[model samples]
Target chain A: MSSPLLEIKGLKKYFLRQQAFWQKWTGKKEYIYAVDGVSFSVNKGETVGLVGESGCGKSTLGRTILRLYEPTAGEIYFDGEKINDLRGDELLQLRRRMQIIFQDPFASLNPRQTVEKIIGLPLKIQGMKGRELSERIDELLEQVGLARVHRKRFPHQFSGGQRQRVGIARALAVNPSFVVADEPVSALDVSIQAQIINLLQELQEKMGLTYLFIAHDLSVVSYVSDRIVVMYLGQVMEMGPAEEIFSSPQHPYTKALLSSIPRIGKKNPSTGRIILEGSVPSPLNPPAGCKFNTRCFIKNKPAACFHEPPPLIEGAPGHYAACHLLG
Target chain B: MAELLKIKDLQVHFFTDYGVVKAVDGIDLTLQEGEALGILGESGCGKSMTALAVMGLVPFPGRITGGEIIFAGRDLCRLTEKEMRRIRGKEIAMIFQDPLTTLNPVLKVGEQITEAIRLHHEEGDLSPASGRRGFFRFWEDRRRREMAAWKKAVEMMEKVGIPSPELRMEEYPHQFSGGMRQRAMIAIALSCNPRLLIADELTTALDVTIQAQILDLMRRIKEDFRTSILFISHDLGAISELCDRAAVMYAGKIVETGSVQEITGAPFHPYTQGILASIPRLGEKEYRIKPIPGNVPDLGDLPAGCSFFPRCPYGQAKCKTELPPLEEAGEGRQVRCFYWRQIRAQREEEGGIGGELSFAGD
Candidate 1:
């Protein structure tokens, strides 16, 4: 297999939480453990889908991979070069090769700027000007299936789907080999979402690009990803090929999550659904041992699940799950 | 089942500066008592507007130009604001997509639920305006009723499966999580035991797991209360799970209406078919996502012919020139397409019927 284009090792991100008056007086420091210890890799021209619920640190992990959020600890290697020690111009060059697409098309795009300027800013930053930059902007618009007439339109004039197309155009203007699409289609309507997904796939094949697609929707992620990484709280609960994980998810958390997805015509829900009892615990005070133990629906769960943290153990070839019950 | 809520040719139009945007342009829907009816549509399709129109809560500048919202044997549109207010929450309650914003942030969760109870169920001689009494005696009577309403609120919280109801009741809306806030919203809506409950994308903002919990709660509530639900959503999965019958809306029109099984299993309308095909299926062998080309039609300036003509794959010359009436397709099924029969036949000839519409029909 070719070397992975981007690899993350034992990544961790902790944000300092604002303390109460008593805690402040006591000089107690508190940290919100966002992306605790997530590790994954994306091969060249392949998509690695990072799936998790909200507050599960999936977005934080994506930002940390792109170095948008400085990691508290761990290493991120792009093209086999460690990116942690890079600074100044080196970091700027790293950013040029790695781009990110945000979830909200409305908030991501500047309301005042025209589509031309929005897509042209990145190319202009790369020193392309005048006709060269304008041509690139038009080309990028057409590539993302937008009309050239929309070039002069503001963000407010366009629809949600159209604004997302503009966002995609801007992301590709840098010609980045790797893109972190953080819930790119989540904000779009269902039909519009499919269009964007197809657009992302087409762009990937045409440009031979790699992706760290971060989304909460498992069905959408499974369709686009070659490999899937499931995160809970701030840890990887399971990782496997898309098909294997979808068909036979090993971890209790993965099973419950997959089963929770309400399919269209699937009747006799009692036999299929494993409705988890409670919501995900606060990440700051995540449960001891298995992070999923609080909501795991497995009957007579092992005592070790509550006391001992399970390491990611390979079940099937390439399929790894972190759960005491798996043992 | 008895007819609980009926909307006939509802026309909710916004008289904006640009033009009259027909938000709900001549749509008809009926919800049977104890039945769950889902309205599946895209963002600008006016599904939510229909719910708001029924509740007499259509925002400013938007007026019900022409329509009759008959609820519990009374024309809601003809009723006065005071009369409508009595029916709004007591007989027909609606929960919105975002509970956090819909809920009053200043009040305690329990107090909000208690307000709903107190509004609909007032005790005799307890209200301050009931009669002239000593000030302290009137205050004492009011306190007694308020405490009774608070007790009912605790029961409502327990019914919605909220833990530590007494403690959580005193907490503010911001103190609750997204799922819990939604549960609190449901508690407030169900406090008065309404006959018809309208849920507008209730689970759209929730996580999948949390969505499952909310859906399950709704199902249980439907059974326990026998409350007819008019569920409006853009998600087919959630609609299929919660609704017994569904109506597919496009550009403020009901393009298709049928049972949930038929809508998901053997849809005839091209828009319904397109929506079904667009969603990525998990267990399917092949990825058969065929996105309907083109954006949703602009609500302000819709085509005279079929509203879905722009994006519909089976559109013909006649569809572009003249509108098609919502005609009966099968038993208890309606389709507003001129070429639905031909389109279904064409797909069947290609053997796409059995292979496609992969909603996990096993």
Candidate 2:
């Protein structure tokens, strides 16, 4: 296989809590392990879907890879270059090659900015000007299935789906090879979701764009992704091709998640569903070893699952799972 | 089986500045005792509006223009506000989508639950308020009843699968997580053991895993209490799993109604077929999701004929000229489409509606 367009290795991001007067004096601090030790790679023109429940650090991982949140440790290599060590103008230049699409199109776009300005801001920031920027903005809008006449309209004038198209147009303005789409279609209606997914797929084929699609909807991920990575409580649980992961999920957590998806047919009487008991454990104090050990339903769950973190082992060719069962 | 609730020709409309919106034009549904009826539709299809109309909880600018909501052999529409209030929590209850919005923020969870119980008891004639005029007498009786109801509320909370109900009861709404808050809402809704429960998109805001758990809990509760349910949701997969009978609503009309097996296995209506086709299933190598084309019609400016005519793939001249009444299409199946029979025959010839019937693998 060719080298991945974007590669993340042992990426970790922790936020330190603001210290109160007493805590400051005592030198005590707490940290939120939002994205800890998450590693994945997206090859050129491949869509890698990151699936997890809310608060499982999927969004944080997406943001960290795009450098929206600076990584606290580890490294990110884009096009075979270590991007974490870059600084100032060099880092800004590198950002032009990668882009991000936020979850809420309403909140992400500036209400005061017109559609032209919103889509042209990236080109303007990259030092394009005058006729070149205007022409590029129009092209981007057409590419995302929006009309150039909408360029003068403000964000409030557009519908939810239209606003998302504007966001996608802005993301493509810079001609980035890799994009981090965090729940891009979750906020849209079902019919609109299919439109956006089709648009993204079409755009990928047209531009050879690689996408790191992050969402909680398993069905959406299964449809869009070439490979899928399942995360739980800030750690990777399973990684494999989308077909393999959905058809024969080896990890217990993946199996539970797949079963949880409601399917339209006669109810299966014998396939026992694994209803994950208890809420996701707090990220600040995640359990040692397998973060999913508390919810694992396997009989004879190994004692090592609580004390020793299992490494990602190859369960099959091109499939990996981090569980003591695999070990 | 005795019918617990029967709604006929329900018409709910909102008087907006733009125009009079026919949100629920004409809907008919029935719920038998201990039966779970699922209302399946996309957003703006009037599924939730039907639920609110049944519960008499339509918001401002909206009203149940015409309908009969007969619950427990009583015409609820004819009842006075005072009489309806008495029956709301004692004989029928509703669980909303967002639990926090339904719950009081300032009050402790215990107080909120006990308040429901106290109101139910007062309505049931089980508690007679003292006529004494002093402030102390009122205060004393209120405290005594609250204290007694708190214990019963804790028991109800425990029965709904809440852990350490006694301890959690004293906590505020913010202390409970999303799933836990929903459980508490369910506990409060079922505290009086109402004969019918109306869940309006209760699991929409929850995660898939939590949604499955909630659906299972509702199923278990129905079997144990022998209560009927009006479960409304947009997820066909979820409704198929939890509901024995399913109704597909569109533009305030139930376009299709049938047993879950028939609805999911061999959907008759164009809208139902479109929805089933759009859903992504497990082990399906073909990932192309054929989404239903076009948007739902704006209620204020509905088309001259069928509301779905603009989007239906098989729409014809007849569909654009006259509205189709929901008619019996087959055994245990009803459809509201001008060309449903023709479409079904064509679908069978073309290999059964995008291979969904084959997916079931009979």
Candidate 3:
């Protein structure tokens, strides 16, 4: 088999919480496990979706892969090169090949910057100057369905959907092979969301781009991804092909997530509305073993779930779920 | 079934610096008692404006130009400011999207609920201060009666599933989480037992898990109180699951209105059909998500004929010149389209009931 474009192994990132007054006096520090351990790979020209709830570490995982946040542990490989260990100039070169499309269109771009400056900033940072940068900016703008005239207009002058297109254009300005789209359409309207999704698909095929699409919306993820990864409390609860994850979700958390999606036409038969009990556990004090053990609906959940961490085992070909029930 | 509220030919316009923006052009809607009606639309579609007009809370520079809002057989539009204030929270109450902003920051949760009840009761002339006000208002008997009503407010908090209602009642708004605050807001709105509850995206700001809990709670409370709800949201899936009937709004007009089944199973308007096809569903085979080309028309500078003609896929020559009237299409279905028959025939020819309406690529 050909090598994947991106490979992540045992990636982890922990954030240190603000020291409490007592802890400051005592000279103690506390850390919140944002991303405990995640591993995944994206094949060339393919999209892998990372799905999870708010504060579940999906975004952190994406940022760590892009090296926006330094991983506390684990390795990230891009195009057969160990990128996690790269630093200084070498890291800067790797950044040119990897870009991220942030979630909030309003906050991502500078309000004072014109569309030209916004899209051209990346090329400028790489030392492209004079007419060369302006020409490249125009081409990128047109590629994302924006007019050349819009280059003079400020970010606030455009609508939400338009602003996102400008963002996509900026991400592409670097001509990156891999892009991390972090909930790119979540802030957009439903009708407009389809526009952005279609644009991304078109861009992917045209640009031969691979993506790590992170979003909490399952429907959108399922529609866009070849493979899907479900995260719960900073750990991969399930990972498999999009079709398998949707058709036969093995993890209790995955099942609840799927069932929670309000179907358009069919009557919901399983009134077993699995409302996962309890707000997400504080990341600082995550439960041991399977993080989802506290809310698993299955009656036969093993005692090992609380004491021993369940390894991600294959429940079916190409389908892996971290659950003691499968064992 | 008796109609609880009827809004006819509602027109709301904002007198802006640029021009008089026709935010809500003309809308006609009816809500039956104990029934849930969902207003489905994108932002700037004027769905919220219709609700604001109903509540007599249109912001500054915006005024209801012409309309008849009949609630419980009375035309609310004609009521005086004083008369409407009397009916605002007593007969009708609104729950805004952000519970934090809707609640006063300084007041305790208990005081807010008590204030709602006290206002309604005082209006009904049932307060213990019946007559003697100047010097004897501080009497012990009157003070005891006031305290008793405040205690009842605590009881209302528990009815909305708030934990430790008595203790939590003393906490400020910031002390409660998003879901708990929404529940607190619901408790305050229900204290007067208003017949009609207008919830404007009450769960939109919440996460899906919390949203589900809130929806379930709203469903349970709806069953117990038999209160009619006008649930406004942009999420069609949530609306279809919760609302009995729905109205699809676009460019300040109702493009389609029908029972949830009819709206979801077979939408009649072109805009409605686009919205349904645009959303990607779970477990479905991957296909190119067909977005409606172009953008929603500017409310200030609307198109000549049909407001949706610019982005509509099936727009014809006549569509640009003549406005289509909203007419009953079938049982429990209304559509605003001159060529729905032609579009339906085309969809059939395509070997599907709901095919994407194609537009010429610009």
Candidate 4:
């Protein structure tokens, strides 16, 4: 395989929770295990889909990869360089090669700023200004399928899809090699979502961009990503080729999640609905041993499931699932 | 089968200073006994209004200005506020999109269910413990009724698959997770065992796994209770699994209505066709998700003719000036397009049933 463009090793993001008065007296330590010990690599010109339910730290992992959030502890290597130790001007230089697309279009762009300024800001910050910068901003707007008429208009003036187009334009302004698209289409309408998805695909092929696409929707991820990484609580439950994970999922959680997707035209729900017994346990107090043991559906679940955290073992070629039942 | 509810020429208008916002314009629908009908539409397409209008709870500045909402031979439109209140919970129960906002945050989830139970009992006209003759009056004999209601509430909590109902009943809405809160909302709505349940995007706020659980729970509820569900959602996939029939709405109008099988299989209307095409399906190839060109029309100032004509792929010259009345296409399916037949015929010739809809790529 060609060299991996972006790599994360044992990423651990923990947020300390303030103790209540009683808890403080009792001397309790609290930390929200957002992204706990996650390791993955994204190959050049390929999309690595990071799938998880909300609060599973999919967003946090993406943000941390982009250095938006200070890593609690981990190493992030981008384009064969260890970026964990980079700071000041070095970090800013690194940022030029990595860009992020946010979920909410309503909040991501400044309401007061015009589309021109919004898209031009990145280039301007990098010292490109005047006519040269203006032409590039116009080019980006066209690239993302937004009209030049919207150049003078603020974010509020455009529709949700248009605002997202503006967001894409801004992200691409820096000519970033890797993009972390964090639920880019989640907020838009279904029809409009396809437009953005298609646009992303077109842009990817054209620019030869690499993506770490993070989204809760598996169908969307499957459509875009080459590889799929499924997260539960704060750990990677399954990682493999997108098709393999979707078709022959090894993890019980992946099975449940995939089966849970309501099919479009199937008249009498052919597959058995795997309704998990309860919600995902709070990450702060995640269950011991296997994170999924509490709601596992394996008929002959072993005693080891409750007592031992399963390592991400190879289930198939390039496929890994963290489940004791496999053993 | 008895017609449970029928809405005829129903028009809901918001008389704003900017102009009359025609939210729901001349909609006609009929729901048979034990039928789950989905009102599928994009945001602001008046699907919620159709649900809220049935429940007689359309927010202020908006009023049901025209037509009849006849339920069980009683005209809901003609019913007084007092009469509507009696029918609201006892006969028809509705749940909003956001469970947290609709539910009472401070009250225990169990208390909410019990309150729904209590309201039905207190207002039940056919109960043997009559107000005129019973020795135990409502205020005087509150404890006896509450005890019964409490038991029923726990039963409801358990029915919706909330484990340990006894323990969960005491907990507030905030204590419950997102899925749990939605389940609590469902428990409250189903507690009274109403004839019809109006679920307005009930699973929209939930996670996919939780949504699947709730859908399964609803499916079970339908079979067990034989309750008719008016399921409203923007998700075709979720609704297709649950709804027996579906009404595709656009710009406050029902463009098409048909059996869920027919609707998902061969959608007659262009908007429905576009929507189904837009969604990125599992195992579907990248070529399938072609976004319908143009935006949904503004309800405040809809076009002179068809609201969707601007974005519709099959639009013709006639669609520019005259609004096509919703007519029966075939086999109980309705379509509002002026050129559906021609479009289908041409599409067939092209041999592209699942083909792209010619997205006027920007």
Candidate 5:
């Protein structure tokens, strides 16, 4: 589809654990496999939903893609150009096209800074100043549906929804082409979350922006995303069109995640929830084979699950799943 | 089937510098014995404050100035500080959203649980074992009672599905996982065999699988202990799952109260309906979001009439001047709305929200 806007191939970001004295003496080592071998492509003018449990590396992946955290391995091609090798001024120039919106609007925002300075800081950093920067700040604030009067007020003075709107304004300040919204609506209340989601959707349409929407919540991701990626521990479980993934999920983990969502009223007959027995395994020492095999609802799994890691292969036309059982 | 806790016209105000923040303004609530009542609301709705008022633990600068909290046969509001302390965690217990913070990091998990048990010991509990209860058996009874409480703490841990209760009991709150910590907290709350358990978003911090586990555990706790739960949460799904009846709160007032079915199914208050519509369901694709128009009004300086009128889609000129009273909408349903009857009639005619929102994508 027009040679995708962002293509990540076998991306891996691992952090070594601070070893104990004895471990260091004996040369024992371990790695927190936060984002391991993740691959996906986001086309221009599209939103790809990344769904996983808290420690499933969705945030890490999002951060690593934007070079907020450098990847230990693999390639990143943004706008059909190799970006993993970019340095200093070159990287800064590339970063002008990428931005991230954090989860906690309260924590992400500088408490002491006024909304105007917060929005203007990004523009000022990008060499824009004087009347143009102030005007651009006003436009950004208006674009995110915030009042002009709010620009002078501090972040703490605004409500959660308003603060989130401010966060959006800051993200759009530099006019980034690619945005990573990491659980943007998670910290907000339902009604507030809806407003933020609608704002993001509208902004995406108007600006022709591409978003890598990262969230633990499937419902939220589904609401605004065109494509959905399901991950467990640190590996992709299933990736497909939003409709296909929700309507007819292939991977067991995806099914479990979908069912675990507490919908109002009766449990749907379409997919009975399979509540996994154990909690997510530690990322530092993930399971040997398939990351999800330990908690996979599929019973009597073959030994291959514990031995061989499944490759992400297309199950349907555009749906990809990493499961040995799928052929 | 008698009412365990009855709160009538309860007004809790935070005496802030800005103004008297009416956190819980004139809330009328009733919870039956063994019934789980879910208080659903956004952050500033004062649901947590109501629970705190029930426990007589409203934080500093906030006081319950008016209203009656009738628990058992007596008015709880009339209780002295010393008397209220006896009922705080004994007859009524609460678990906060964050178990990590709610739990004492310095103390062992079991110690805290045992402390709750020993402090709120039933007078008759130790008497049976120590026969001939005269001047003598005081020291003997104390030792025996202490031993019983220790065992009870472990028993509670086991009951809430904490594995290796004996070992986990010795560990501090930080030692346990997120799910285990919540279970431990639940155990401590249930240790006193509290008749009314007030859980304020206990499962919010947990993951979905663990949330399911915790919710299932709470359901079991209610079934086994017949503990009347005043469950407060922002998650409607969790509310729908655990609550028999739910009250939707908005800016220090309950907009609607009904059975779980009515709250989720045929909600009269536009806020309740809007709340249900806002959360995207898992089963459906293209989650048609119909966000309420504006933010909840500044509680410090609320509007002339309805607090929700500023955001409500169905708000009219009449709503702007007159605050709607909480009136009986139908059987076992109370709604604070001026146009509920007409809305219900319109729903019957137009199938949903009078064509405003048509259960889009359902």
Candidate 6:
């Protein structure tokens, strides 16, 4: 089989914290480990979902993969070529091939620009001009299920779902081979979310595009993804085929996350939900060994979990988890 | 259980520059003493406005145009501002989605809880001439009241499961985490042991695990305190998990009302069916999310007939020109649809909606 379309190896991104004057004089420093030692890959025309809670660094991982924020360590390969260090013209060309759809549609789109300019800006940046650019903008609008008359309307004139469609159109304007959809549907209402998700899947099939779908909602991720990666406190807890992971989640963290979802039609809901002990610990000072040990609901957690970080070991053919108990 | 709150054809209209927006159109609702009734709808569907109208806290330029909010044998719409103030926290209290904005940033968490306690219980102790004539006695009474309130605040903090209530009480809202802040908000709302609690998307801002914790706390509150809850949210999962009965609102009207089980298992209205079909079940292998077409109609300029007529998949000619009153579909179920019987019959003939949405059973 051909190699994957994109792969990441040991990716890490750390943000330095501002220090006090005394700390500076004493030569002390601090860092927030936003994304630590994460590795994953996406095959051609397939979607890989990244699921995590807030402050778990899923968004940071997405941005770091796109080189929007430079990684402090490790490698990112696009079609088997290391693109981490690509600069100047090469970086610009790579950017055209890799685009992102942001979480907040209201904040992502330019309020002042009309739909025409918003979708046309990318093509214009790529050196398209006048009639060709305007025609391309109208085509993109129609592709995303918007009317041609809406091309002249401003962002404020549209509703939430319509604004999100505009955002999706902008991301697809440059015809990127890889797209990172970051919580694209979480901001939308339930009915509207389905519309956008269907639109994304349809566009993926039509354009032969690969996606890294990131969201906290597991149900949405499970619906749209081929494989799922569960992260916590800047570390991957488990990764596997979506059905296998949902059916038999090996990692305690994954189990907790799955069961925490409130399902309808249950006579007594939350009956078997494994309520975590406390909120996620501050990412600034994560736990020593297992990132989830602070809130892990496993019985008789191995003592080594407090000191030694477990390696990601494969359980099934493609299912992998990081936990001492799994070993 | 006795009827704790009853709203009869309640209407709240906002007169704007463009037109009069009927945020909470004429609707009837009732809540028993200990029942948790959920108001389910999308944004701009007037579920929140209904809760606000019941609390007598609708913002300016929005007035209760018609109908009566009979709560505890009095019409809340007819009450004066001063009279409504007395009923707000003591009779009914509301907690919003964002705790940071709802809570005072400058005040300590403990102080906020104490202030809420003082508002309802600080009475009969302050005599007529205590402020002027008996200054010393007034000072003594003030100290006693303050001491009592502080103790009650700590009790409330402990009751809400805050760790180290004594220490955390001194910390401000900024110091607490997102989940902790919500717990503090709940403590303040329940400090007086109000009969009814209005949670307006309280868990929408929280993460999943955190939301589960809050839901657990709310369940415990319902059982221990016997507080009637009017939970308003757009999340179907959360509403079904917490509420005994639910009212599904469309535009400014409640399109359906039934037991939570009936609403999820065998819905009648097309709008309700659309909402159920739109949610992607967790364990379903195939993605069959049948999204309801079109956006929620503009409340300011609604259609001449049914507000949902523009988006209903089963819409017919009669639905376009005439409004359908919410009729009794079953013993206690209600649905606003011209052809619900036909819709239910069609679904039954086409197998069942259950097989499509079945969860991965344990």
Could you say which candidate leads in DockQ? 6
TM-score of each candidate structure, all chains considered together: 0.97, 0.94, 0.93, 0.95, 0.95, 0.97
lDDT per prediction? 0.90, 0.86, 0.87, 0.88, 0.87, 0.91
Between candidates 1 and 3, the one scoring higher on TM-score is: 1
List, in order, the clash count of every candidate structure: 0, 0, 0, 0, 0, 0
Error of 2 at B214 (Å): 1.1
What is candidate 2's lDDT per residue for A1-327, written digit by digit as tens? 878888889999998877788998898888988888988788999999999988899998888887888999989999999998788898888888899988899999999999999988888889999998888888898998888889999999887888999999989888999999999998877777878888899999999999999998898898899999999888899999998998888899998998877766755622577788878888878888889988787888878999998889998988999988877
Q: Give the per-residue lDDT digits (tens) of candidate 4, residues B1-362.
A: 89999999999999999999999999999999899999999888999998889999989899999999999899999889999999998889998889888888888888888888888776342133434445657664465567778888898888888889999999988899999888888888888789999999988878888888889989998889999999999988889889899999999999999988778777778888788778876854445687999788889899999989999887889889999999889877899988888777876787655333321110
Between prediction 3 and prediction 5, the one with superior DockQ is: 5
**TM accuracy, model 5:** 0.95
Superposition error at B66 for model 3 (Å): 1.1
* Residue range with the least summed lDDT across 10 consecutive positions in model 5 chain B: B353-362
lDDT (Cα, tens digit) per residue for candidate 1, span A42-141: 8899898999999999999999888889999999999999998889989888878999999999999999999998999988778899998888888999
DockQ of each: 0.72, 0.55, 0.46, 0.53, 0.51, 0.74
List the candidate 5 regions with Cα displacement exceeding 4 Å.
A19-26, A267-271, B122-146, B353-362
Poorest lDDT segment (10 consecutive residues) of candidate 1 chain A: A264-273
Docking class of 1: medium
Which of candidates 4 and 6 reaches a greater TM-score?
6
Global CA lDDT of candidate 4, please? 0.88
The sequence of per-residue lDDT tens digits that candidate 2 reaches over residues B40-133 is: 9877889999888877888989998998988989988888899999889888999999998989999999888988888888632434455567
Cα deviation of A34, candidate 1, in Å: 0.2
Residue A39, candidate 6: Cα error in Å is 0.9
**Per-candidate alpha-carbon RMSD to the true structure:** 2.2, 2.7, 3.8, 3.4, 2.8, 2.2
